[model samples]
Target: MSQSKITPKSYKVLAVDDNEDITELLEYTLSKEGYQVKTTWDGSTAIQLAQSFLPDLILLDISMPIMDGIEAGRLLRQIPALDYTFLIYLTARVEEYAEVAAFDIGADDYLIKPIKPRALVSRLKALLRDKNELAYSSTEFRIGDLKIDSLSYTINYQNKVLQLPKKEFELLYFLVQHQDTVYTREQLLSHVWGAGMHITPRTIDVHIRKIRERTGFDYIKTVKGIGYKFTTEPENT
Candidate 1:
């Protein structure tokens, strides 16, 4: 069975930018598109608001006083409640490293600023659509002693709870669901990141490494010349 499409009104967005004008534009644009919107001027305030608002997506500006988006994103990623929240960077920084830093902190997407409201809304809709598709069934399942609860996005191993960032969780969940089916990096990107998303194949490797670090190498195994897969058999590590 396919998941139902999420309506715009059912979506909530938080826009954070030091520029009042840009925030106002974001509010106006997204609101008109039927999303519930909140605006904040600084990263700290955005974090506070996110805890209460629990927004489905965040439009964050990379440059802001008191706290920058990168720091805010890192902290936000640590919040288990916001683990699945989509974070997109709205910044003027066009440097390659800046984009790398954003992705390193778990950014879902990045938009270089000129504040094109319509295009931004399009991106948000696409992202939310992809998220809805990735949403797992509410049921929880176990592979040996490892427990993955789709409802709360929690992983329990050996009676201890483990939390991974959003992307990592999705990647691991996908592999576990399709145990023993080896997937190439490009295939994993399309399946997990969704089609047309600007994620590269290398991003898959990075996420795979992190997943191993957090959950150990028992489940997901790399196929030397191919890609990776989840297996019930013990890895020969």
Candidate 2:
């Protein structure tokens, strides 16, 4: 643990995989690093544990017998208590679309298989550090009948309350805060997901599509051959 960053012991981690050997290894590795870790060999059990444990981070595997990682991740995001929890996929899937699907399901980060204990810890540390900084940013956006509150991590639209997945919310927040400004996919990737993220531009498209699906197309406008922008008024059809 780094003195300059929050202590690992302060964070709880849930590691889910169908392989008992993998889970045991994860438990041993993460526990040795001072993090409070809980492990389960299946997604169903993992979901149950998460409800009770409410871990700050989850390292999930994409392949499982009964319920896969994608389904588990989706259900986890639906848990209001776990909305802010960081999810990193640990899988052997190398297809580009697989990564895109992970992002679409609100994953915070994605790491391919063959987990490296030290590197995994470092990634967790970085995500945890970012979480700390985000806590201090008091951001709320009000435009017309819509309101976005970073504090509550909720969106108020037309007297209705909505909660989007973490990535979708952040993407929408960024576009709204910089309303009417056209940004290419690359630029949005840099500003929203950070420059170091390995996600492709297609991931941005998936996020944007999800955002539009939840909130409707009235807020986000596509620039046809360009990218996306946020607008308060409806665009001409």
Candidate 3:
């Protein structure tokens, strides 16, 4: 079965690569697909452009002169205006550690080089679709002293506002909404990250840890030999 092609032209993309040819290819291919594309050959310029362009997605190369995608991604995450912007590392690095590091630094997706244009477009469509669906699903949630506002993508804990990365916030929201229901890693992966995605289950743990650290809340209960649950009655409360 073939799925219908979604509108790609409505989105803006920022492509950053040290190789001019790669950037050119990205610009040409994405432009042909109707996307508003901008290209940069250096990470520093990519960062600067991102502030004004405010792209919906960023295609970054891990190895670049003057600055690298990892550093650039870290800095981008700190920008409140770009908090919801999708970030993808499009590089040639194949090491597992590199992939893990990219996600740790807040990349929404990671792709290797030599990819087919059709496949790249498909990936982008899927990512954007998932993002939009998540955005429209729910608007706000309140659990105990924690409050989540999906529109702003911000959380309030004990009246203190704390901003979370996109994935972390989604994970926390999902668990809190279904409080006390035990969810296995696989279930969490499906519900929070979208079904059939290549993301690892351990990624859930990383987000969970970050949520705990940021909120200083003990509401998420780890079920041994199973998974985790968000409890209404937090331990030691």
Candidate 4:
């Protein structure tokens, strides 16, 4: 609520962090970039704010009391008002291990902290630009018993909606793009995450596990030690 920067043209950014100082920094920095910024000191209020405003993107902090950024992001994705909003994890922890788990929880991008004001602005702008483009692209695709509505950001299996985390939905979307064609973890990471990050092969394993828990993991085929492929439709699962 404390203002130090001029609001952006008209974009809304929900900045959530348990640390008041960090949320203030994000609000100050992003507002200067012309974004209408709102701040929450906890994930609970972050979800409320998101439910009300439905921001174009969320700047989420990884470490927080109660519900963490991962849980917050997951909850926000379920809110119909904020379902399609992009989520970026803002954190001081950039170690390889945490980074993988962060993405597995469904962050579009993870930014290492001590972030320069201008650099952060640039990244936000780029993310917004790309997201806007993808939004208008075809959002619905159907294959056998698997169906995805891109705009809704929801997936259905045999007409029964499947509860998948953001990353799981994205991974499935990518694999379905080339059905029956196996893609390596390296390939999956590159295509899904882009070359902007350095991540491990195990990242794929974690998400695949979560995916299986919700809808049985075997549908996503693992080539022993290689990559994964979307092998069977629900009818085939």
Candidate with best TM-score: 2
Tell me the TM-score of model 1: 0.80
Model 2, span 111-176: residue lDDT tens: 877877887777778778766755556678899999998767789998889888777887888899
Per-residue lDDT of model 1, residues 1-237, tens digit only: 965667999999999999999999999899999999999999999999999999999999988999999999988887878877999899998776777677777877777889777777887887787566556457677988888876677899889898777777878888998999999998998887666655556777777777778877567788987898988886853
Off by over 4 Å in 4: 1-10, 18-21, 65-80, 95-97, 100-105, 232-237
Which is the leading candidate under lDDT? 2
> Which regions of candidate 2 are displaced past 4 Å?
1-7
Worst 10 residues of 4 by lDDT: 1-10
Write down the lDDT that model 1 would get: 0.83
Q: After superposition, how far is residue 80 of candidate 3 from its true place, in Å?
A: 2.5
Model 3, range 1-237, lDDT digits (tens) per residue? 843434677789999998888888889888998999999987889889999999999999999999988988989888878987999889999777777788788877778888568878888887788777666655788877888887677889899999877777778888988998999988998887667666666767766777788889899998888989999888742
Whose TM-score is higher: candidate 1's or candidate 2's? 2
Query: Which 10 residues in a row give candidate 3 its minimum summed lDDT?
Result: 1-10
Residue 52 displacement in candidate 3 (angstroms): 2.0
Q: What is the TM-score of each candidate against the true structure?
A: 0.80, 0.86, 0.85, 0.75
Clashing pairs in 2: none
The Cα error of candidate 4 at residue 13, in Å, is 0.9
* lDDT by residue for model 4 (1-237), tens: 742332246688888888888878888887777788889877888988888887888988878887877787777766766655778888888677777767666667778887678877877776666545445565677776778876556778767886565556777788877878888988887877666645676778887777777765356777776677876543233
Give per-model CA RMSD.
3.4, 3.5, 4.4, 6.0
Q: What is the lDDT of residue 130 in candidate 2?
A: 62
Evaluate residue 115 in candidate 4 and report its C-alpha lDDT on the 0 to 100 scale. 63
